[model samples]
Target: MPNAVSLAPAVSAQSVAPAFHEPLHTAHDDDAWWRSSVIYQVYPRSFRDLNGDGQGDLAGITAELHQLADLSIDAIWMSPFYTSPQRDGGYDVADYCDVDPMFGTLDDFDKLTARASELGIKVIVDLVPNHCSSEHPLFKAALTAGPGSDERAMFIFRDGTGPDGSNPPNNWQSHFGGSAWTRTLNDDGTPGQWYLHLFDSSQPDFNWDNPAVHAEFERILRFWLDRNVTGFRVDVAHALVKADGLPDWGGRPDGCSSDGYPGHAAPMFGQKEIHDIYRRWRSVLAEYDGDRILCAEASIDPLSRLVNWVRHDQMHQAFNFAYLHHPWNAAELRGIITDSLQAFDSVNAPTTWVLSNHDVTRHATRLGENNPEVGLDRARAASLAMLALPGGVYLYQGEELGLPDHLDIPDEQRQDPTFIRTGGERVGRDGSRVPLPWRADEPHYGFGSTSGGWLPQPEDWYTLARDVQQTDPDSTLNLYRSALALRKQLRLGAGSLSWAADYMDTDIIAFLNNDVMVIMNMGESDAYVPSGTVIAGSHADAGAEGVLAPNRCVWIKLN
Candidate 1:
């Protein structure tokens, strides 16, 4: 059977065929790999540069799997490397089935996946489903076809409100930094129809209400599945479906803010109609042999609503962002962990914990004042704590190096649209996406053989580079290496967690995962630890006997 699907008449059948074999995908029971995996996110352009073109590419990623495998992570969740103008860091994909030339060719991607598979590393590529590069052939046709044509129906195009059709249809706003609508000139050189873009103007939203959109995405999925990729990390997972009537969202009068518009109950995002698409996608994955997985980047509020996307028949794992947003307080962290675990447990889905990602500030910078040393201590402690919890985990690139956000990147060098479009009021995500420092002595710290990466690296990064810390037992890099080794040895990935009554202090979080004791002191003073053999510690201060230092944590073995 081919991966052909029919549109529901809202779109014309002539636009796409209902039955045809383009490609195929299959799955296997193979360890239920997603259940207890530690997945690392690789932002392609900033990870490594193979050709020293100062741009990271597929060949660079393929060459770096040994480092990831050595770190003991089970999988890799790579950011988008598809062809695009890079208006939004590759999230605005122009092609679904091919890799961008800057990232390398399809052959490079296939070799990367094959190498990762050989290392027992599952490859989960990013899939941008909500919107696409406006340059897509379908969207180009939509612009050329004008109103009432099947091409125009492929996207969310509508007539403007004013008499001359000069005003937008509603009050929606872009998630990047401006109005969600962008007007285009007609083929005849006259002002024409408006199209909705949830983010940048170059990235236009698709009409999921249109059947052609549904069938097209299904084929896209099969195209990658045929390439032997393990799964997809869906970008903007929940905002795909629009509500009835595309009603007014009461967004800002200026039509742009740092966080963009509210999505809690907005007509454009978090609608109930989105899950049906996932359910269909889930069925398609099941058609294959392996337990092909779907993980979401949905930012819905309320643990209950967030859990809805991870129901047994929908996605397998959804990022537990609530846990990430929690401050470094013992009670707050514990409360979020309990709530998140309970919510996902109810759905029989595994909770995925993360402290840093491409979209936010690094935890080292987030948990402390303007103090890098203090921030590093808290970040190391937090990493050990998150790894011990009973769920999967996501480690962002450069975080293991204890890297902090580059707070001083020059304005001219910054590339994130969020920063450029917001008129500099917001710092945006570029600071956190700066190139990584791999060698202490090399220019750009070994991110490339010659020049600095596409994004510049700060001078201070040399001290935290991989070459400086890889051999040091007490370095943050080595600490992660040792902790993950122990995590696997203890089988802490899926287990029951309980608070240790005797080890509890006002700001101390001491929990037992299965039987191994995990302790963290988030207070201003030292806390007593119960009798047990110390296995691992975040910092040298945790080396003291039965005493865990402030902003330090340790894993203990107790039978």
Candidate 2:
């Protein structure tokens, strides 16, 4: 049995409770402020637009910092805004140091950094270390230098005749389907050699084996830290290192393909050597104040093994995707939360939870696309559950308002490279990437009248717009504000957590911390309370509850 953190003695439900506000505690230097804080991810292209270019930019983000501050978010994880050809939705970096002109100038980034800091929110940018655009100067140099040239060694290059002259160097398939290797013909007009790409052929993988690569990335980290950027959300971080020797993956009956090749379970990508690299990054982060965080994007399930990446020496946290993928069920959610807490406790490593992100379907759509109330209720429940956990939490943009996935994208208007590659079987992320609706009546939903959004805005979003919700006392946005205020007021982030006695009940998910008990119902119907007086809930009436209501939550004071 796990040791539990005891709750403070009971208080009356009718007492007008004081708000919870306490300074955040730090576990170590180079650790993320988000460990005990709430972070909201802003996919810049979809967050807001100030310039009317029909795209979101750094300036737009700067303009919207107050919205996040208003919600009491502790930090912001801005997606990649670096120069790119948009081949992989800005994941393919053309320049690491400068902001893409489409997003705005370096001056704009400086302004955003300063404004976010002023608002008390840490800014963490996405760091894509695994690959760069095929148009990158390094790739061009590799092409011009030919095999055996030092530049050619910067990336993986192989020359050989396959079983069939038409086959690739290996059987690996790209994440977007088709062969992972693209044949780049030599300048001599001879048969082209193959280069590896894990995703789009336009985005080639980086070779971490090179000393120059590590040094270059370290310098990049320092550049941002020096500029006051708090930290990084490492993209495909596990792929930084790859297995040597480029061995062919053995065939599997499970239909699993590696890189595009059948049976390629190469240890190269998630190799243990990655730890050494993480340690190196950690050391650099320490040079600053150790307050900087390094969050990894490892999507593997059975989160136990993934937590290893966060055990003090490697990453500060790795986003857990399993719970995000599960269906809404009382038993399932309870098991997941309980098991995850247990796993994190075993290692003494803090955990991080995320329900929606730029890459996944919006939670509102997951709950029930047509029923806004259901979606809003689920959003409230999810937020409450996430905050009550003992570790960190991340909330995607527009999630607080219960934004639903935009299913109205026309076939021709789709922009996601993944959807294009998969022939639309895979829902492109464009639906979730729609511009934020700041005001229901404003032109372009208050994103910008003159500036056209990169992705189309959902017409329905206007109904749930920020400005509209701000006026409604019972709106989801206000609920989020209240939830965040309560989280801070209770000093919940700093308090130790324990599974309460009734925590395992299928209908109720409860946790005790100091004097507070947070209980949530994942069921689609009202849940009966066994004990405890409700202090705050998804209701104005405090003591009248019999069932928790579909997707409702409560923060209770135990007697």
Candidate 3:
């Protein structure tokens, strides 16, 4: 093991327990904090490593609480640190109530939450109720109990087809690729029943039809709530309840027609039964004193269908994926924002905006396409525009530094199941999930004292390290800090958006939120700057001056 580096003192949960239980942000209305809160997504394994074990842990997160607090984020939505098999990056949960040994113990998580609470940052943990690690004791017990037993009934288990029962029950495909079903072995080493796993075979889907499954998840929610988590980000929120009878999707021979959604009908998702689960969860959140909330990771299409998850009785917010997946064109973005506002407004729910997360190519690389400098500029512009919108926002870790996807990860070191299952035909999400760079001169970019973290970082990241960006006034990190401060000061999240219809058809996207004018130039040529005192901009050259540069966005204070 690498020699342990000293860390800031950790505040014990016992000492802070009394104050931590109380609400931290009394400045914001308790009933509406979740509506427009700026939440930062913390992927623990890639965030920071306190121990010299090459993987980030709870202690690392606790040590960084002050950094998030300084960023002015209202809450931190942590990715899973629960007892997991490390498959799917902790999404393959083996136990719901405990932290993984790799991440640290229960007390360590308690300390992390306690520190976060003290910093006025609410903790919202990831909750994967749709499935569990196959190695979980419950799953293992189901296997040992054989078919038709009470334990086996808790998970979706169906017999295979063909003469010797070799094929999967349905034609559904795994998100990671190949068949969605994995057959189990009997006592005699013969093929037994097949279990459904939408993502990977190691993560078996739960049978929500079973009341025992409901009871278990309810208990899991209470367990985390009792530990003082503000809320949950429900994983694959649209996928808990599969269509009745598990019908073949859209009569397609291979059943892989529409990627994640499967078919036009989407038999595997958007099922009506899923709402009842959220309704019950909403009630559970209501039992808590804080404005406990649920944010859905439902990848449902068409803003209309997506709005259902955020009805008053369900989730507080669902990710506005239409905005995330839209092209960087001004017209496309304008259309998506308009649609998102209208659709979400019908349900009286806030539209959550996110530019990049752990699952996709970072916006810096994605928007720039081929040019690195251009990508960084566009990313900054996008951040400014996203923050100006009227709703909650999620800032993926390292996004503030304008980090691009580390596209050069060696094939041998790749761990994502999507990469392995696809035989490297597709690069998968590993590029975007690389460990963050904290310091330029330190070992492993200061991720850990000993190593460069679980995944390799690009050498170019030295200049982009968090410390490097913090010192530079014009750096993307400082840009985010400035924008977040202004966002809070102006209460932009609580405001409403109004389009500058005169520029609607042009390549410029101009809008007003709470009397602050926001404009972006997506045209081929530089556009004449609008009449206003330029307050904040995506580029250093942006000021009360000549023209707004192409691929840049600006926030103006109109007199």
Top candidate when judged by lDDT against the true structure: 3
**Rank order (by lDDT, best first):** 3, 1, 2
Local error of candidate 3 at residue 200 (angstroms): 0.6
- Which regions of candidate 3 deviate over 4 angstroms? 1-31, 250-264
lDDT of 3: 0.84
The deviation in Å at residue 289 for candidate 1 is 2.3
Model 1 misses residue 539 by how many Å?
0.6
Model 1's lDDT to the true fold? 0.82
Q: What is the TM-score of each candidate against the true structure?
A: 0.91, 0.89, 0.93
Identify the superior model by lDDT, candidate 1 or candidate 2: 1
The residue pairs that clash in candidate 3, if any, are none
lDDT of 3 by residue, 165-194 (tens): 888898888889888899999999988999
Residue 330 alpha-carbon offset, candidate 1, angstroms: 1.8
Model 1 TM-score relative to the real fold: 0.91
Stretches > 4 Å off in candidate 2: 1-32, 160-165, 250-268, 369-373, 503-505, 530-533, 539-543
Candidate 1 residue lDDT tens string, 88-109: 8998888888888989999999
lDDT of 1 at 291: 65
Worst 10 residues of 2 by lDDT: 1-10
Q: Order of candidates by TM-score, top first?
A: 3, 1, 2
